[model samples]
Target: NEQISKYAVQDPELEGMGTTCVVVMLKEKEVFFAHAGDSRLYLLRNGKLAPLTKDHSRVQEMIEKGEITPQEVLSHPERSLITRALGMENVLEPEIGQSFEAGNGDKLLLCSDGLYNMLSNSILEQILTENAAAQDKAIRLVQRAKDAGGYDNISVQVIEFQFKEQKIILPTTPLNFFEKNIDESSENISPTIPKVVKEKKIVDEEKVPKSEVKNTFQPKPEMSEKTPPAVKTGKKVPDIALIVLLVLFGVVLTLFFLGSGMTKDPKPSELNISQTPDTNAVAEPMNEEPLDNQQETTAITTPKKDEKPVTKPEKPKKIPKDTLISYTVQAGDNLRKIAQRFNMKTETLKKLNRLDDNEIKTDQKLKIKVRTVHTVAAGDVLSRIADQYKTNRELIKKANDMTDNATKRGTKLIIPLAKAE
Candidate 1:
């Protein structure tokens, strides 16, 4: 991204092509973008409008350096003057970031400063929230910007994303009707999706066992006349009839006795009498002796309330000491200015160096705190160490008290994240 900007700056043919550039890339619901100049990228997510990129303008620099308040930027004379842009210099450093998580119903709107300068964030949010297509939104935003006395170039790019419902519809046919695809097992398919169950006939015969099937019909041999009088048939019917009459008389007497017993209306003595207990009768009884065994098992499984397991206390993290280095005071350098240059609090420098005030003279040696120190190992080089810690070789050498020479193996150095100019 920087290479293209560098080329544009160096090429003579692109002298008139110096302008702000903003490029946005969307990846897996995440939004990333690189921006330079006064162009802006705004996000409307969850009914809130937020700017994703900051303009590389003079007012922005003033705001960063604490020279002016953010509220002043809107009316500042140099609000439109950008400090950084492609083709403006031999090198360009655009602000790029991927911290925004874009999701459904999220709108990403990219536009030049013309649109933002005329419309407030609330107005932009309302426009973006309207139920309209992206192309129509972009055109409406441009037209709105033009309507608001916008003489500068007006450009708009709107991106709106939404989630769609997923549904798996089954074929409207019975399992047997789809005979061609039945050989495949139904269980292997996705459980979330509806599937047709295969009929028993579609199942391969080899896969089914034959023993599960049973036959219910059987043929019987006809009775023959030659097998005559198996038991002498009706010849003994007279004797059986006399025996049946005697049995019938005895059944009638027994039935009459039972009817008289039921019609007796249960005598008071008989109703009051309880059923007599038989001494010979025996009953199984439940044994509760295993209750003690259950209690023992519970004791074995559960921990004792009185005795708790001991846990060791974790060791506290040690605060690393900052490396103390000397800073040679330069022209226009004071304690405050030097502290600001190093991104340090002014009072911290004063307390660390035992300085009474911000007053300091040129060429005076001042003590500065370097945040980290690293010892050189085998195959370690100054450049490699700088890259490892995101520092430069000159600062490392200065912090380590070395000259402009390559550091040897086993040498120790301090990596100063911030140093005085």
Candidate 2:
């Protein structure tokens, strides 16, 4: 069947473009499928078959509400039309895949409407009931659709779930290790985060296969509270370097001020430089004596010698309290580098300016402390992005006014977070 879009239900720019999608996720015996548009998912378990996800098109909705029969939907003008898309809206609420348990000998079928449109449910059931393998079933479904006049793009996925003996290893402290890595994976590792994981002897290392020893766990998109573990690379943290630099600065300052104290006084002959220009200068240097420790009378004069001792310069006071903090965006400028220079975080800078990303062009004026902006980069997730600025993900959501945790690559973000610890 030809897919057609009515003028009223079409985007002006992309009016006639339409396609179908079908995806599957297998978690052991359980399977999940998320779909959009007019794609379909089917399950054949225990000699029984049923449709999993409902189509998002007008024909399917009418069929569900008993407004149309199966025969009428096959010849409808809008039979192959799409009512939903992935990148067509500001807020995308994708239909979640329903999870179902698969028996030892269960088969799943994912296909576009091209296959199911021409074949009856009874005929499809008989084909699946013949105990065909996944590959054979997929091939047969494709052949049936082609034989019945393949009028559109056709795709199918046939999956079979079977039991296999695999060794499972349990972690000793999943939560603690998970949290510690989460903290260390950011800008700096907090001292409170443990350096190493405690060992467990329950799972023998030699017996466990090398492929089974997985230390990382992937985070689900729907999960807002959970975060993935940080992959360790033995890199030094910025806080450690900051501490070292501070100590070095302190030592230098101390030596400079202390060396100035002993220069308060000068020798009498050394001070009388003009009197003995030539002959006395050579002989007087040898005749100079060290100052005596004991004296009946104490010398309390303020100016001991002709030369004055050096004094520290007073700090500037003409500039009043800063009324506003300002920053000028230079060429190739971004919020992250600017924040780092000022010892602030990107989230903090974004909040001050009410911005979402580091999208400022050259010659743009950014309110350095008044608002914050952050650009989402690759390998960046909500939890890790929040941790880098010393804040939790919840605060970031509130500042950006977003409930969805999904952030795209190169997306500009706001960081209003302060140092939590």
Which candidate has the top score in lDDT? 1
Point out where model 2 deviates above 4 Å.
1-18, 64-66, 164-421
Q: Please provide, for model 2 over 1-421, each residue's C-alpha lDDT reduced to its tens digit, 9 standing for 90 to 100.
A: 0122343135443322334455565543455555656677777766655676667665555565465665565444334334454432212234555466555456677887666655656556677766545566667767676576544445776766544332222223222332456645765533221223121111112221111111122212232563344334443348875675566445334433443343312211111000000100111122223333223355564766787866789863221111122344544457887665444677867876667776665434455431234445445577977766555666666544465676644333445425421
Maximum-TM-score candidate: 1
Q: Give the range of the ten consecutive residues with the poorest summed lDDT in model 1.
A: 270-279
Residue pairs in steric clash, candidate 1? none
What C-alpha lDDT, on a 0 to 100 scale, does residue 321 get in candidate 1? Answer: 40
Q: All models: lDDT? A: 0.52, 0.47
Q: Mind giving the per-residue lDDT tens digits that candidate 1 earns over 282-360?
A: 2222333231133323434455899876668988433244434445465556787667545467888887666787766
Candidate 2 weakest ten by summed lDDT:
272-281
Clash count (model 2, backbone only): 18
